[model samples]
Target: MISNAAKAQPRGASRPKGLETAARVRKAALKRFAASGYAAVSMREIAADVGVRPGALYNHFPTKQDILKDLMLSHMADLLQAWDSADFPEKMDPLERFVRFHIRYHLEKTDEVFISYMELRNLEPDNFDLVEAERRRYEAILTGILQDGAARGRYAVTEPKVATRAIIAMLTGIPNWYREGGRLAKHDIEDIYLELARKAVAPGATPPLTGDRMT
Candidate 1:
């Protein structure tokens, strides 16, 4: 007979062996892959970091490339899920909403962002296709937003797909040099970038002041 205390001890108290091992493997792999390029990391090193035998690692991930594929796929899938779950203001402009969301999301997952872009060449052809498909799906979200805004005459974008590519490239580059205690706070950076993105497509944006002219 089981007691209430036993049932209420919480799930982590008795986590399944398989799940625990897999999670440790993922953690070790992520750290290794990020610190060193994927090509430089070996299954034995990951297994050693997890305090498991190399052979045991193969039981979970048949090959190191499999682990790399999983990591890449998971990163993109998580980004898509986060975007899907984001709460946007009911009255917020779509472009503004997207700008804030992209900045905040990418900033929070800097390591994942770094690895995803830097390690693409390491992925095999089929794996690359799978990851790229998810990436394009995510990109489509912004493209759709720009297209709708243009159709409503809120934005001056002539090519929604081109605008999407440019905007995403600009936003995703933030994690490269941004630091927590930098001169600008994350919100400040977001505001600046948001305005930049808005003006990039804004209909009838004010012309820049000339050398001798002031607005």
Candidate 2:
């Protein structure tokens, strides 16, 4: 039998020193890229942000584009993993589960979301294709969900792919204007968007009880 200490540990529990430094580099680069556009940020600036020398930063990432690609790829991977692990009651509406999950996940990852959407132009052609492919994999999840609902007569969606893009655009746009201490709490915003998303697909669905409705 395997010993308790032999059990697999959670991520980052016993990562190597080099990997830890790399993680810091990613975090610093993410903040810098999100604050100023990727073109405006530099390897030296990222090194400064990580409290490491330029050479040390280079040891982990050969180029700024590498860092950006890593960030984007990792973001997509994490999003996919999260959705796979998300728990909801079997009776929950699939669309509702997706809306809530998307809203909540993106809200917590505003910085990653911001850079992922805003910095697509900065990636090199090869890198762009790689990231875009991962993005499509994510989009396909919603498309499949929409198609299933439409087939079940639960959603009135005529074009699952098009509706998938539109719904994602609407959901992902929240971070652009959302503030932590805003008039509406995070859940409040989720409630409103949930209603909008439901109505957009499920004709005649009653609006959610979000007291202050969007005009």
Candidate 3:
């Protein structure tokens, strides 16, 4: 029963005009920044990608630095929010739940992950501090989990904070070589990494050396 005019409106036209344009700008910038380093992408290119005038882009973001800052901070915000809503079972092993959640989330956000790490150097000092604060907040979640697990004799982590960083680096590296339709399914990869992570922190467990046994 919808009228032709209603059907003809572009998708998301119901959103406020300014908000829609800003979303488009962020999307365009994320793609460009992921493909090319943040320092290499320009505001003009982002505006053009969004089908907006360069001057119009300025209305939403006063400068290119603002856009980069927004992208990094937004990524971290989404990450933290996702962890909050992950809804793991009350009885689940905290380390297992965290490993599964982190791997699955980062796999789905490879571009955001790419720019978050690769473009960090391009953020202004003030913006860098803001984003770094969010990063530390996320890291604190894992560190807390590690501390609890160690206290309960469930894990062998000597330094919870250091182990948190090592685990995160290992999990986030999956995106570098992961691809759709790969030899290993996504869940398979998750299981493998989870086992590796488990062994890494298991009491008195020695990690297997490379060329030992992997299938």
Candidate 4:
């Protein structure tokens, strides 16, 4: 069986000395992608930033695209599975459960979501399709939750699917503009997003209908 800390224990995959190097490479990739985006960043530059030779970097990831894909798929899979297996608060209302989700997801997987959203066009078609499908699956979870909340009358969006998409867009936008050391604490940002989401789907939002009501 694989060790609890790792998903699989491949030969030569684990060593204390190399663990630090691998971590550096991963951090460098995330930082580089965050600052410069996927298409403009290169494997050689990433390796240099991590203080490894270009060829040595392949020891951790076979290709630049491979690196991006792994980074994205890990969180995408987690978010997808998380919602499916999630247990919401019994004490809180359904809308509050939705609020809690916005905060938790952004806090845990902000970097991955940032990359997935910004770098889609950089991926080759096949790879992009794989990532996009996972994303769509993740989005479906929110839409499903919204649909359920609407049915229960705890939430009141005219179109559950569109509301779902809007809520996600609004929540995800937090990380884009948020800075770790910025004026607002990270938790505060999460709270703001949660409140915004609650308002978006709050019962009896009255305005002239616009856009696809259901998406």
What is each predicted model's overall lDDT from 0 to 1?
Answer: 0.89, 0.91, 0.91, 0.77
Candidate 1 stretches with Cα past 4 Å from truth are: 1-15, 205-215
In candidate 2, stretches whose alpha carbon ends up further than 4 angstroms from where it belongs are 1-15, 203-215
163-202, model 1: which lDDT tens digit per residue?
A: 9999999999999999999899999999999989998998
Residue 70's lDDT within candidate 1 is 86
For candidate 4, lDDT tens digit of each residue in 1-215? 66855655553575765878877887889888988888889999999998878999888888998888877787787776776676886787655665567667776777777787888778888888898898777677677778888888877767776877777777777766776787888768767767777777778766666776775
Q: Write the per-residue lDDT of candidate 2 for residues 93-137, one digit (tens) a residue.
A: 888898899999999999999999999988999999999999999
lDDT, residue 213, model 1: 59
C-alpha lDDT of residue 174 in model 3: 95
Better candidate by lDDT, 1 or 2? 2
lDDT measured at residue 37 in model 4 versus the true structure, 0 to 100: 87
Error of 1 at 68 (Å): 1.3
| Candidate 4 structure, TM-score to reference | 0.74
Flag clash pairs in model 4: none
Per-model clash counts, in order, read 0, 0, 0, 0
Candidate 3 similarity to native, TM-score: 0.88
